[model samples]
Target chain A: MSLLRILFVVLVAYPVVLIMLGINVRHRARLPRRGPAVIAANHNSHLDTLALLTLFPLHRIAQVRPVAAADYFLANRLIAWFSLNVIGIIPIRRKRERDGDDPLVACYAALERGEILLIFPEGSRGEPERMAQLKFGISFVAERYPRVPIVPVFMHGLGKSMPRGEWLPVPYFCDVFVGLPLKWRGDRESFMGELEQSFHKLKEKLAAPEYL
Target chain B: MTRLSLPPQVMYALLGAVALLIIASAVVLALARIRPERDYTELKLRIKTWWLIIIVFCLAIAFHRDVSLVVFAFVSFLAFKEYLSLIPTRRADHRVLFWAYLAIPVQYYWVGIEWYGMFIIFIPVFAFLYLPMKMVLIGETQGFLRAASTLHWGLMTTVFCLSHMAYLLALPDDRNPAGGGDALLFYLVFLTQINDVAQYVWGKSFGRHKATPTVSPNKTIEGLIGGVATTTLLAVALAPWLTPLTRIESVAAGVLIGMGGFIGDVTMSALKRDIGVKDSGTLLPGHGGILDRLDSLTYTAPLFFHFVYYLHY
Candidate 1:
């Protein structure tokens, strides 16, 4: 809603999304019509959030909140401003998880408010070729709101485009695979396993020649 | 200098282009009606794109010189982006790529100020040396030669070659023959494009032997000759109004642009072949990408610039 953030998205973020990322948002029709839903994607680069946020329908963007790590997103005043306001990121303290604080609390509140919470369940950026173990935080939040749909998203090629440790991004084609959403059945372990399996299936489907 | 004035030749040429487009549209419409079952989607989309391109380009050149430069600057930026996106690059070369993108504006800035010295040397001298030096500091020589060559090639074709059109527009009003800079710009674009269409038509009609079978099978010796001859004749007809060249010199310039246009297109084809892409990108609906639309300009722009610059400037 901030004027500066809108300007930044239009002038800076959209161009980066189009030219640098070459983002293809596939299965857009599968995105839940409304929220109190969770959109979980594999983390590969910093661009994944921007790509997904931009891919979300513009009218419903205000209700889309991305869950970002506190240490990374809140590292500075500028980044924090961009993350908090521009991206509407719900900063969760990943490092301070054991300090009697539940990171899922903020996410749960967001879902309860009918906000679409975008969380990278891998907890951090990982290799694009493989998906890491899904953090329990995602399933935990989904169980509290069992009716909510958890959409499995697979991002292709952002890791090489603007991976961690690279100050500048190279132009690379990236595809965002939005799969059908799954509802929580209250079994955290099986839910997480199914979520991971869904990601693998999405990745395989995208990699197949017929999809291209 | 009548800075805001549009030359009579430019006005007349634009009118002619509009007339041609309308006639072409009618013909295509008739063809669609006659052959309703055949797919005319791609052809219709190409014509639609031509309408937009003609309007945008003519409007750009119709404005003040600096505004036109900005339009070309934007084109260069997109072309460069498309080229880089298709090519392989390393993480270490990201900073250098940033500099390469920055060079687009700076190169056009030279045209804005008419600084020929810096415009000519900035990319070749400063960018050429600076990219490698920056890569050396990164100290990753894994794909060093391949990376450096691709970066330089992207800069040259995307920024350096494409910027020549802006520079041609920047030529002093008095030195650019009777129709001045605007006419000259339109002349080059019009002729180069017509040359492309001519080649396609000729190739389709009478093309026999493949020019470069492996590199570009569609190009043929017959097409090349027919295209050059057609362009040369058109050049002589439009010479007095569009360019400073005398009739004979216009014929020579026509040959240069015609051949250069073919070479540039096939060069891009070879690049697409090397990279194993059918099209550079899908920005333009039927044209595949900006690179696909402007490939001939990559060669024709610089060749025409130097030819004019040598004769007049």
Candidate 2:
């Protein structure tokens, strides 16, 4: 099957059928899931990815490309089925030495089509207390499709539940935060740094609003 | 036997007085935070205002007897005005808005004449054409973009849409006369409002998580389910006494209204969120405004009324 079509069946169809069966689904943001959208979030837990998998009901936004680590979902069928079919995982090879790997090129192409792409630019999961600096992937994708708004998301306390494979996540309700959409200017380095700070600010906002 | 006495007409006279008292008391309860001094004065003014409304309402009930639709038409007019005031429109499209105003009567006129075909087409097709032509006549030259949008919204908000409230005035079914046309009005109104109230109640009581926290924080699964459950039960019980519906039929009809009402409420809510406002206006105290009351009605009125008209009528 084609890469794009396979991704559609996975990201859009699977979770919808799950929701109809009553899987305790909830959508957090007030924003419209339509038009050019960027779902960028903190890369803490696997739930940061799974939560988005169930967000859309309308079939128009079928292809959701998750920027995934090559180390995690590279060769396993369970992960591969999730990546290719349900979640539409776009594998990012971070070796920096591997030739002909072009994951960023794939992401840019998806963005141009006005597809929903989930990117976590903390590079990798950080220590529990602190938010890691964001990678340039968000800015890179934003630059490619400047019309789309990069929406910042924060998933709290997800990493505490089975971080890096204990088989099952302990069930406890934690707040999910989706901030307002941010428009990207031409500057890449500054935008990346801003996005990093943006994610941290979201966490602070979730814990307790600074204004209050 | 009670009819033999002259007290019924007197009792009917007291119906207006009773309605006034209930409304005044309800408003007092809703604005429970008002200070005692302001409260008494507000209550007095409220009674006076409701006295006018209640007199008009009771007078229509007493005199015309079959003019419930006319009362609803007035309600629709108020609702349309509230909606038009809130929604932004281009100033160049005055002719379109004028035609939209013209549509209010034309649609109700169809109900008056019982011309279902013309009534249905009057807004969506005819108004659609007439509006653009009106815009083009002025020949602003550069304002076409704004002109087109304003004209369409005016029709949607004012004319093509609101006429359903008038259509509902014709709701007294052949099967039951006791309920009268006002029963349909009561059904549409209560169903819409209770759905909103029920959602809030359910959300507050059992809401473990947010459904659309960013767009609407109050919406939750617990609320949606609870509201539907409560409204469904209420609809089943109320529909039989109020309309020509049976126990099962009432359940089915209520389910339709409950779900349809929710969609209409959410759609209006999303629109408000997009515009970043709470209530449409303060036209009606404790209810926000006329548009706030009418949002669900706008979609619900036509929906249930048409459903009853085609299948049940």
Native contacts, share recovered per candidate:
0.15, 0.00
Q: What is the TM-score of each candidate against the true structure?
A: 0.88, 0.48
Quick one: best DockQ, which candidate?
A: 1
Q: Which ten residues in a row have the lowest lDDT in candidate 2 chain B?
A: B1-10
Which residue window of length 10 is worst by lDDT in model 1 chain B? B279-288
What C-alpha root-mean-square deviation, in Å, does candidate 1 show against the real structure?
A: 3.8
Tens digits of per-residue lDDT for model 1 on B67-174?
Answer: 888889888877886676667677667677777778888999998999999999999999999888988998988888988898899899989998998887788888
Candidate 2 on B1-313: residue-level lDDT in tens? 1122222323443454466468757777666655544545434544444455456545434444236446545665555644544444443444455566567766777877767789888878887787778778877657676556744664675455656656655544444453545565556655766676678768877998877677667778788878878888988866765666667777777777777767766776776665556655321122225565556656777777776666566
| lDDT winner | 1
